[model samples]
Target: MYLPPHFKIDELAAIHAAMQGSRLATLVTATTDGLIGTPLPLILDPREGDYGTLYGHVARPNPQWKLPPTGEAMAIFTGPDAYVTPSWYATKAEHGKVVPTWNYLAVHAYGAVEFFEDADRLLDVVTRLTDLHERSRAEAWQVSDAPADFIRAQLRGIVGLKMPITRLDAKKKMSQNRKAEDRAGVIAGLGASDDPVDREVAAMIPME
Candidate 1:
């Protein structure tokens, strides 16, 4: 996450919000074999630590859990992103100095990785995760909706993960480095585009 000062996201609340908005995260860890990564949807426990705690799980048969991680793990959360064409910038016509760039938001959380298999803890974590995602659905679902035996059996096929986050690297590269006129052109261009993600990126860009 090579974030310049203008794009850095240092506020804890803002970073947490970005993570929550983008619920899915990629967990990356280094092992004797090589770097292993898994994309998982994580729930944050904001009260757990100075930074926060991440809760998620991976398939029981996944090799990532079997190998011991030699160093810290990283969880990456990505928000809306859009492609900015040089044609969208005012500078392109004036001096032809602008180039294409992407506007997006992302957060990287680093911490010690902990894997667990305790039935009680796994059940709790799974249930909470389910609730977090299902809360927004029109027809929300719950863990208990299934037969207890079936749910318990399903849980057996996975391993739980808990990482107490120690460091956060967040960036919102939303054309903040561009001049006011260039930024305005970018916003207007994206806002008019058909891609939903582009519109989202436009909404994130600060007024300049």
Candidate 2:
């Protein structure tokens, strides 16, 4: 994350919000073989530690859980992102120096990777993750909705993950580096875009 000073997101609340809203994350670890990465949905538990811990599980057969990570692992969470065209910048007309860029938010969490297969811990992680994602639905599903035997059987196929985040690097690049007129132009252009993500990105751009 090569973030310039103007593009950095220092607010912990803002970073946490982005992390919580992201369902999928990329987990990276350095191993003797090389850098191994896994894309999965992680559950963030702020109560677990100072910076919060990530919880998830990988298929029991997935080699990532079996790898020996030499140091801390990294979990990446990406938020709303959109392509910004040069035509959207007021500077393009003023100085013809504008270029395309991306407006997005992301968080990188680093910590020791811990793997476990205990039934109790696995159940706890799965139940909490399910509840977190299902709470907003009208007919929310639950682990209890299925038979205990079936759920137990399913749990056996996966191993749990617990990463206590030791470092957090967050970035929110929303035209903060551009001039006010250029930023306003970008917002207007993005707000009218065909992609819903562009509209969301437009709304996130801070008013200068």
Score residue 150 of candidate 1 by CA lDDT.
94
Q: Which stretches of candidate 2 lie over 4 Å from their true place?
A: none
Clash count list over all predictions: 0, 0
Per-residue accuracy of model 1 over 71-112 as CA lDDT, tens digit each: 999999999998999898888999998789988999999999
All candidates' lDDT scores?
0.94, 0.92
Worst 10 residues of 1 by lDDT: 199-208
Worst 10 residues of 2 by lDDT: 7-16
Error of 2 at 98 (Å): 1.4
Colliding pairs, model 1: none
* Tens-digit lDDT string for candidate 2 (130-204): 999899999999999999999999999999999999989999999998888889998999999898989999999
Best of the candidates, lDDT: 1
